[model samples]
Every structure is written in C-alpha cells, then in structure tokens.
Target: FTNPDSTLLTKAGHHKLCHYIALTDAFPLPIDKEEVSWKCLVKGAHRNEEMINKLEALEANSTLKSRVIDYVWGAGSQLRGELIYKARVAVPSAYSLPGSVTEEELRKALNWLIQRMQLTHPDINAKVCWPVLYSFAQLTSLKACTCSEDKPWQHPIFPHLIKTQWWGRKGEAKKLGNKEDSNPFINTPITLMALVATAVRPFLVGLNIF
Candidate 1:
C-alpha cells in the first residue's frame, strides 16, 4: 500500500507467506467464508487466492460449529464479546435527568461510540437513525426521562443486557468479595449476617429517598 504506483500482483509477494489452515483432521472449519479464504491464503502463496475464488464460486457445506469455535466465543473463566468492561454508567451531570439518559441522548451516545469505534469497517460513520425523523425531531424532543433504576449497581445496560449480562449474589453488603464475605464470625459483627433474599435486602439498605 505504501507504493505510490503498484500493480495488483506487486503487493502479492508480501501476501505469499500467509497460511490458511481451515481444514485439519481434528478441527473443522468455522462459519466465516472470509476467514476461510484468508486462512487458505496463509497456508501457501499461489494457493491462497485460489481459496478466495473457491469460496465465492462454491456454496459452503454448512456444518455445526466445533468446540474450538465455542471456546473462542467465550472459553473457560473468560467473558465474551465487546462491553467486557461492563459497569454502571451515569449520565453526564450537565443533563437535567439526575440518573438516566433520554432516548435521543441514548441514541446519539450509542451512535457516536459505534462510529468512533468503527465497529463495521465497510460502513463507516454508521448512524443510529430512527424509522421516521418527524417522530421525535422537535426542539423539545430531548425531554429527559427518569429511571426508577432501583438496582443501578447491576445495570448491564444496552449490549450488556442484549448480548452479555451477568448475575451475582451477596451475603453481606459491607463485606467485599473476599474470604470475609463468607465467614460469619469475622463479618457478622461488622454487618450482621444477611438474609437469604440477598438481591432485595442490599438494594433497600442505602437508596436515596427513604
């Protein structure tokens, strides 16, 4: 690509050492045709592009994905996909709503993030547009909506809920996620032994209004 003027084959040599290991006796091919094509490319030089054409020319013999595919999707002890950094998000304080995001702000925030990250290379500056512009395009359209977010701490918002969400139980609120969380003698005095309804008890302890 650095070359000011070059032919298609000019950059071909660099791509020569690429290898495509889509098929082995033990491991079956994954679902992506592009991956298989690129995989074929790395296996050998001239053999690479042949796989690309082959991928386009023929229909894939579809098969169930293997365990290897599953593991990569989310292997042992590891979480999967984007928003691996899921955490409670607060709306920028400047906005009128104290704890929640409006529909438009939410849309714009998501749109900007998706575009900045370039989640899809082919489609840059992807827009999170509405079905009908006239629906919510008024000057007063940005009216803030409040969230009765009783459980703000566990909000696996957006993609987190849609694609990835998790649940956790707690015995004592004061106790951190450590050995003390479990041992009654050490933690009971600090914050009495919590009831079995762990989800509700902790939520009621320190909420704002009452």
Candidate 2:
C-alpha cells in the first residue's frame, strides 16, 4: 500500500512507482494477483501525464478505441469484459456486444464505428462519444443482466439489485432473489457524466475532442 501523501518511491524508483500508481489510479484495488495472469507485469507499468496523454491520443476508431476504453473502464469501473458483454446481450443499451465480444473484439468494433462516424461528422468528439457509447450499452443491458455463480462482481454480488428509476419515472425494482442490492441498475446519464467529467481532460483537449 502507498502512503497517500508521500512519494510511493524515490526518484530512482520512478519507473517502478509509476506502475503501482497506474494500477491504483486506473483500477479499484484489493485486487488479487492470482485471479488475473498479468498481475506481475503491471507491477512496474509506467504511468504519468505524458503517458496518459499518449494513450488518449493513440486512436479512437472502434477497434482500438473499444479495447482501450474497455481496458480503462474495466480497470477503473471494476468490470470484466465477459460480464459486460453478457449484459449487452440482455438489452439494447448504449452499445452492442454480441455474445462473442471480447476486449479485443470490442476494440475493433469501436475503431471501425468511430472512424465511419468521424468521416461523416468530422466534428464528432471521439473521447466523450467513445465512453458515452460504452456506458449506454452497459446501462441499457444492466436492467436485464445477471451474473453466474462463478462470476465476479466489481462491487459485491448480492441476491437483489435495486435499479434506480430512470428520469424519476417510477421504475420497478427487479428481484434477483437475494437480500442485498448487488446488481442495481446504475443511472446511465449520471454514469456517463461522471466518466466524462473525470477523464483526462487535457488529453481530450489535445485531440480536439472536448
């Protein structure tokens, strides 16, 4: 664990410290290395404003964009590709993910979709649009998605999920047969807003996607 206010590592350890910061900043922790195979590699991963800027500017076409966005969201939002994709299957939300979708697959899809959209609407803001679409896809499907016994929950896996009523429209809570509200339907718009608000703003500005 890093001391919040102090430097995690010395100047000589910049490269090493960068990785841990990257993990902490990009994903929710209490992460178990054994569960995922790439744990060790991430230990010394580089992270910085320059690196972040580079990543944000890499490309936002459907394919690469989707993968990058998925990685970013998956890390920070604490979602897994299989889980999110499965949710996509249950509803026609912000974006679509067929049963076969993977982080790699979605990356390709987003790259193609965003490129086509950009050609016709050059004024399109890829940064905001990319995540917005992803969120839309996730939220629409969230209303009807569920996890299996082996599935991991970003939050806690509970028996019941309390879906918030959209637009204060008096929506009903669907029962997943548990006492806890584990899979609640997140407010899509708010989720989207939060994502856009906290994204690396300078990077978006550089891409002229703000």
Candidate 3:
C-alpha cells in the first residue's frame, strides 16, 4: 500500500517509497482502464510539480533513464523483465552477507544503493539527505580504519568487508542458466539492520538499553 503520510512527498521519502515499491513489487499494473498505470505511482508521489517537471526534463539525459522508462512502462525484453523480478525478490536477503561486515562497509554499500536510486529517480537529488548520507558513509569508513585491533575487532574471513561483501558470499555466486555468470557484486543488498546494529553496539556497552 502507498504511504498515507504526506512525508512521502518529500524527495528523500519519495526515493524511499520507490525503493519500497521495487523491493515489495507493489507497483502492479492497473486492472481497470480508468486506473492510472504503475508509472503514475512515481509521478504521484512527488509534492512539487515544478521539480517533477524539471526532473522529468533532466531524466531524458540520465544514463539510467532508458532502464527506468522500460521498468515503469513494462516495455523491457522478457529477459530484462525476468531479471528485474528476480532482483526485487532477492533484494531483502541481499542485506545479509555471509561474514561480519564493518559499519563502514555497510554504510558505503547503503550509500551506493541510495546513489543508484537517485540516479534512477533524479528528483531525489533535491533532498538534503543525499549529501548527509554520503558524508556519513565516508565518516564510517574513516572510523572503521582507525579502530584498534587489540580485541581482534576486524573479521578474519572478510577482512576487506566492503569489497568482499559487495561481491556476495564467497564461492556461492549463482550462475544464470546457459548464460555467462552474473557479477558477484550485482545482487548484494545494502541492509540497514547490520548498519544500525554495528553503529550502536559500541554505545550499548555497560548499559541495558535494549
């Protein structure tokens, strides 16, 4: 269901809603002729008409514009449609990597997803959170690098968590039928639970905040 809160109209909220739609397969084709097509879901979520117009204009030149159009209009090839469907189904699990992922790695992966989303929906660039998310990712990366290893804080299996986590579980990468193998990094989800847990764990020490 569409979010009833007016916050859905904000740029950040709009992008979040878009991601929700993708992850949940919520944008179904209209059953009745009078009902708006799935494409209008994105259009209707925007609060600012002028911004939407500007974004629509700019989207014509975006690198991901064609794919976005194809996804929205349901005009992609059979293979493309199947791939999109599979990606949506896999998104929720993509957040859970096999090994311990550092806060920095999690944040970087999340920011990468957000940036990719913004590219898919250019209107999200209007949100101030865009840069805030980027800065947070960088700060987390720096913090992770500076932490002492006296307690063996770094994960041994995936010491370079960011790179390996994005590439999926080692040696378990799935291959599509008859076709060449997919990129190991392509299906990974940037999960929020891991990021939140990692970011808050240090603060939870000696305090029963649960």
Candidate 4:
C-alpha cells in the first residue's frame, strides 16, 4: 500500500474526516475477498494504487470539490447512500454527455456509486437511503456542469449556476463540524473570492483550452 502524495492525501483526509464518519464507523466487514479489499481501502486500511488514483483525482478535480464540500456540510443529515450514488454518477457523466445524462446512464452510475458507498459505508441502508443521496449529487453536478469548456463562461446560465455551486445551501453549514468559533458564513469573504475566480476561469481558457 502506497501513501498517496501529500496533496492527494490531504484532500482524501479531508473527505474521510469531514464527510465519511458514519461510513468509517462500519468497515472491514465480513465479505468476499474483493469486497473486503475494497472495504479496507475505503476505510484507509491500506492505501494501494487505486486508492491513490481516487485520492489524486479527487484533489485535482474542481467539480468534485464543490460536491465534497456540500456533502461535508451536510454531515449526519440522515441521507441515504443511494441518493449520493446517483449524484456522484450524474456529475461526471453529465459533464461528458452532449446533453443531460440519460436515465439509463444515471441508473448505471447509481449502481456504481452504491458499490462505492458499500465499500466505504457498509452500514448505509442502501435501498432506502439512495434516493436522498442521489438528489445531492444530481444538484451538485447540474450546477457544476454549467461551466464546462463547451459552454462559454460568460453565459448567464454559467454565472448563475456557478454562484449556487460556490455558495451552496447556507442551511447545511452547521453540519461541517468546524470549530464553532471559526465557522464560515455562507458569504465568507474567501468563498466570495473563490466564486469570482471560478466564474472567471473560463475566460482564461482562451489562452489554453487544455
């Protein structure tokens, strides 16, 4: 098992620490070897290549950042894993899709996300919990995909959705578990700056689309 590079480990650690507490509580369960392996990695049992890749990708991906941030802010809000899975699949596939993602692809992604959550959060009651989780990912992805390279950043839709993506839902902030004294407001100065930067990022692509 390889320790991920610092940047990746840092992001993964933030996710594990901030968003996966309940999932962490139930791990290394009695299951087949592959499932056990998946569970181990999800629980940080042994950092292997796949784990490193996931961590690295998570760190580098701006799309994942907002969703992860939102998920963390809603900690212990009693969401079902199924819903989360739908949202996860929706984000990437939607970005890749020419149009909105199809129901079939969304379903497949939901299945994939279920497996991921099972490996990471075995205690999750999938059948009942998935819908709630799906809503989060769907909304986050919908908001994020508004500014893809194919779309002009200056488009009204891009700014509006990106703003929602940046600000997120103010009501969820209390669940983040940050030290109460330093809890961030929905309109934190830094967040506002970040929103501006993200909104303007599309203009920079004129220099290099890649």
What are the lDDT figures for the candidates, one per model?
0.27, 0.29, 0.33, 0.35
lDDT tens per residue, model 3, 1-210 = 122222222333334333333323333344521122224434544676654654464357554343333343342123234333443433334333213455544455445434333212111211112123554374322321121224332322212333332223432222222233443223333332232223223322212122
Tens-digit lDDT track of model 4 for 36-97: 32233345424557656774565586566445444333332222232333334333322232
**Quick one: best lDDT, which candidate?**
4
Task: Name the runs in model 4 displaced over 4 angstroms.
Answer: 1-12, 16-163, 166-182, 203-210
User: What are the RMSDs of all candidates, in order?
Assistant: 21.5, 20.8, 19.5, 21.1
Itemize residue pairs with steric clashes in candidate 4: 80-129, 82-130, 83-130, 83-133, 83-134, 84-133, 84-134, 87-137, 87-138
For this target, which candidate reaches the highest TM-score against the unseen true structure? 4
Task: List candidate 3 stretches off by more than 4 Å.
Answer: 1-21, 26-45, 51-71, 75-210
Q: Which residue ranges in model 2 land beyond 4 Å of their true spot?
A: 1-77, 80-83, 87-112, 117-187, 190-210
Worst 10 residues of 4 by lDDT: 119-128
| lDDT value, residue 39 of candidate 3 | 40
Ranked candidates, highest lDDT first = 4, 3, 2, 1
Query: Residues 1-210, candidate 1, lDDT per residue (tens digit)?
Result: 232221222223222211111011112234553354333333323545753443333334222122212323221112211112232121122112223534654555444433332221221222233333566674433322223234322222322222222212421222334465463323323111111112222222222122
lDDT for predicted candidate 1 compared with the true structure: 0.27
Query: Candidate 1: misplaced stretches above 4 Å?
Result: 1-77, 81-98, 118-210
Q: Write the per-residue lDDT of candidate 2 for residues 1-210, one digit (tens) a residue.
A: 132211221221233222232323323343542223123223322455443343344344345434433333333333223223333332222223344545544444445433332211212222211222554375332222122323322211111111221112343223323334442233232342222223322222222321
**Whole-model lDDT for model 2 versus the true structure?**
0.29
TM-score, each model? 0.19, 0.17, 0.18, 0.20
